[model samples]
Target: MPPARSDDDTDGTRAALGTAPIEPPVAAWPAVGTPADGLTEETGQAKKPRTAAFGFIFVTVALDMLSVGVFVPVLPRLVAEFMGGDAVASAAMYGLFGTAFALMQFFFSPLQGALSDRFGRRPVILVSNVGVGLDYVLMALAPNLWWLFVGRVISGVASATAATAFAYIADVTEPDQRAARFGMLGAGFGIGFVLGPALGGIAGGIDPRLPFWIAAGLSLLNALYGYFVLPESLSREKRAPFSLKRANPLGALVLLRSQPQLMSFAVVQFLSQLAHLVLPTVGVLYLTFRYGWDTTTIGFTMAAFGCAAVIVQGGLIGPGVKKFGERAAVLGGFACGIVGLSMQAAAFQGWMFWLAIPATSLWGFANAANNSLMSRRLGPSEQGRLQGANACLQGIAGLIGPLLFSQVYALALAAPGTFPGPGAPFLVAASLLVAALVLSVRATRRPG
Candidate 1:
């Protein structure tokens, strides 16, 4: 070939590398300063296209809540069926269920989030929905207590749609608007609680397993809707290649190291979820053990909590944001949580318990405001990253809260009754909220 010309040699080299024109690596897409990198989303200036994706995510997640909440009423009862009717054992089972879910999330949420960053949000979402649906079916058919454990384990791994959903919003939003979008998801959480539990309670009366079947069906339906309708939000150019460390929950620690503001917000997020973890797992156990209430009475009490959350998230959140600004709303919300915690801890009678309703309403409000604040702080590119980290933090709380509450409950039973009451956790959780309030005030303070 006559000592191949320089042009010919260059062409051969380029061909071997499969870049005849020297195309840039896909890493360049989300690289700092790239338009598609999600930086603009942090600005809270997402265009119409991003808004549409946000709406899609909201719908799918709402469906997830519908299934999960519907099953809550029956979870303990079903466990009792296997424990030879020992309530304590059943309660332990419930705590174990939460432990399984939270522990898995501790590892999985970040992985899913990072993967969505690379593979695009659509597939991860679709897979999660399917996994959630399957989880419901498994629980419904569980032949023994172990099966229930298996179902929870599987579901926990699969129910990570929230991570992908958050990423989708990030892909389309600006940093400033992230909080508002996240608040909308919180609304979905509230709505799911309102409808899911009420319906689950009713269905559970007929057959303890009925709610699980219904939830499974809904998850499958959600999967179908998602596969057909959810568009790809993270484009090929914007994804990061998957890394073990980045995909793990520890990624939050790694990513937050460089961003102190984000780290502070993440701490607040963890504490908030920690407070919640005490309630859902231990609250009902307290009512039943202390007051000897049945499913119907328990359902009514929880309904009160759920209804308040619904109204706060779905109805009042927008106005609150408009009136108070995100920071003020957050502070006010936390203040409400403090009040509610006090009410629940002080409740020695049913009427006093009712007072806790308004307090939880405040908790809902504060959570919404915090979410909105965090959203605003992120650039679009960082949305999935932060949300994933947030999920992991919640998972961490989930893991810690149940074990702590269960241990406390056990200790109270064991000692000459020293752990105060089921309300003790609420007291601790409340104090934590007060600390959170102080932190929020400091974080949002304007720099001189």
Candidate 2:
């Protein structure tokens, strides 16, 4: 871990990490610089989407996350029910489900991004929507825990299209506008946050499977909407041949190595992604065990968190970035995460937890800022690949995060009293963010 850099660059090598002004990558990949090397996929390409069409990407990611959010509060409970309400067994099984899901995403993410690069983003996105919709159907109908587990695997494969969606954003946006646009895209996640959990909690209260049905309808309907509204973001000439070498999980990591500057960012991002998984994997369970909250309470609390995210990402991100710059924003986000998660970890009363939501909500500014910065360093032809590489990191985090946090939580529960309590998972997450904060400082430092 030499501070992430291509220090060999003349002067611009220092630009990407500097605070005053950031320059483009001096050594952007030239091997695929032009669209010349491979046979392009035969899929018919539509023209680049209109500016208004940008809304489609936002909506697409929203619907995708919304479907995910709908089950967050209840999925663990459903597993618990199948296990005779044994919390420990359910936690272990849920971690396995998460790990299995991440395995699929790890394998498929680069493929999804590469496929979008070849065939175009529109079809790749639409197909993912359909796949997700159908997977929800499977989950809704699952008679047993393993059946639901299988559904999660499918969802991971489908959800890997998030890389493509980000690629779509890169395609349509200017370099300067990317950070703001990325923030707007995060607002989509916020929308899901606000609605999905609340809806799932209410619906899940009636029947744990009900939220999946609702999620299925939403995904299908979104697919239909996209079929009519979403056009291709990548033009035919801009398309690259589908390279299996860059499409698999291992190959995707090679893509990260291919760019020396991205290594540090990718590493920091992996830690951030690992920290993020705690909420989904153990947040609900932690709430249930620690605070005695029911399904509805968990959902509403999540909704509140979502609302804060919307305000920060949707409303404040652009102005914040403009005033503070991406590096500053990134630093601020990590600081917020450390404080917020620590606050959540220390909160003994349920009401104190509410104050932590906004701080954590603001943590997304770091991701949006980091993405904008990374996307600027690559060419259009490689945006998908870069995001694929990043998603591969996320897949790895997804693989590790769930098991680590869930097991920590379960172990804490088994403890007699004092150390590693129910708050243990957040404390661990906060620690990961602290590591990220340090790594990011090194990554963002100007080259010597």
Candidate 3:
């Protein structure tokens, strides 16, 4: 028999007609485990575990990240091509592009969150996927840098996936189950980075626009997959009405503040996120300038980091959190970040730089830790808003991180008398982590 759709509205209509039990929808795949014995009494039917739904969300996240990753290697060069290959001018323009993208995310992500609250996660995610695909198409066909810029801005506005996806995870998973799932979400990021750049670089070597075309196809395909397979995690009773006032980015931050220790947790997330931006923003340039590494070598390093991330986030987080608890995991992750960034700052030898990858990869624990901790503070109705507010925080970090890292690195290079030299940015990033660790300690000490 065909599995019924799991839209919350449809769930009611079908139940009234005396159809199947009220379990979340999954595609008609083979069942793995026995029907859950735990929820049987309350639900009045044998319920398949919703981990299958979690699988769908995982694929959604991985594909979204892959699509975004496909363009990363080529974007600055594309901007440079528009600048007549003027490196300095292209650098400034690239920073502007990053800022503008973040600006759009800052303004729109809260609206996306509120919409998910009013409607449901599935529609919001579908819209985001379609928008991303369309945006890639626009970029691929762009005739000028400004046109590409517009495409980027649209992509930012379409950035609903992170907030909604996280909220969806929260809705389906139990409190104890959340950290591991969040780690899996982070693993999706690792998978994207591992595959996206290699594909992008190869395609880009043939034609700069080809990767964007590929990205477009991937996104559209993902949207189609979601349309057929993705179930609504949010139910009608749990959804809150959408509010423009609530959707305001500042208002979202206020929401974080209203909850106990939530603002402090936000601060910890912001600093850690900001610190982590060093790799993507200026990592390649730093390696070239300091270690005299070639593109192939840099690519391998990135792949190694990605693999390590997958191991740590996908495989290790659940066990580590289970044994040590979320608070210890949070602090330990920060500790790893501090040491890792410091290693990068001080590494004069190539092998020394490589060692930092595993250390830094373990820092993935901090992200899941913070997310799991914060989600517990909000009601199910407010989960979307909480994720939305966190999106705004990411936007803020995105706005600042790229520029900050670039300037610090650039000044380190040009200023001969300045100490720390090319390693200055890494040092600065490490310091940010140090601060984050201290704040996290205080945060973990307080009651929710």
Top candidate, metric lDDT: 3
Question: On a 0 to 1 TM-score scale, where does candidate 2 land against the true structure?
Answer: 0.82
RMSD of 3: 10.0
lDDT of 3 by residue, 64-147 (tens): 667667777899899999999999999999878878877887888788888888999889998888888898899999999889
Per-candidate TM vs. native? 0.80, 0.82, 0.86
- The ten-residue window of minimal lDDT in model 1 covers 19-28
Model 3 misplacement above 4 A: 1-52, 83-88, 414-419, 446-448
* C-alpha positional error of residue 366 in candidate 2 after TM-score superposition, expressed in Å: 0.8
lDDT of 3: 0.80
Using TM-score as the yardstick, the better of models 1 and 3 is 3
Per-residue CA lDDT of candidate 2, range 1-448, in tens? 6766553452353244454324445665223323211112353222233655677778778876777677777999989989999989998898788678768878898999888888888899989989999999999999998888989988988877779988888776655456777898889988987787778878999998899998889888888888888877677888888889978878878777755557777877888889998888888887887799997788778778878888888889888776557787888899999999999888888988888998998899888888877776677778888888888898778777878998988888888487757888999999998988887787776676
Residue 163 miss distance in model 3 (angstroms): 0.7
Candidate lDDT values, in order = 0.71, 0.80, 0.80
Predicted candidate 1 versus true structure: per-residue lDDT over 1-448, tens digit per residue: 5774586675575456432321123432234543333444346343544444566678777876776677677888888889999988888778788778768777777878877877878888888888888888888899999998899888878877787786676566543344455667777877787788788888999999998888888778777876766778765755677788777777655776545555666788778888887678687787876677897788788777777776677677666554445666677788888888878876878778787787678676667656545544544445566678888888778767877767766666566446465577778888889888888777766545
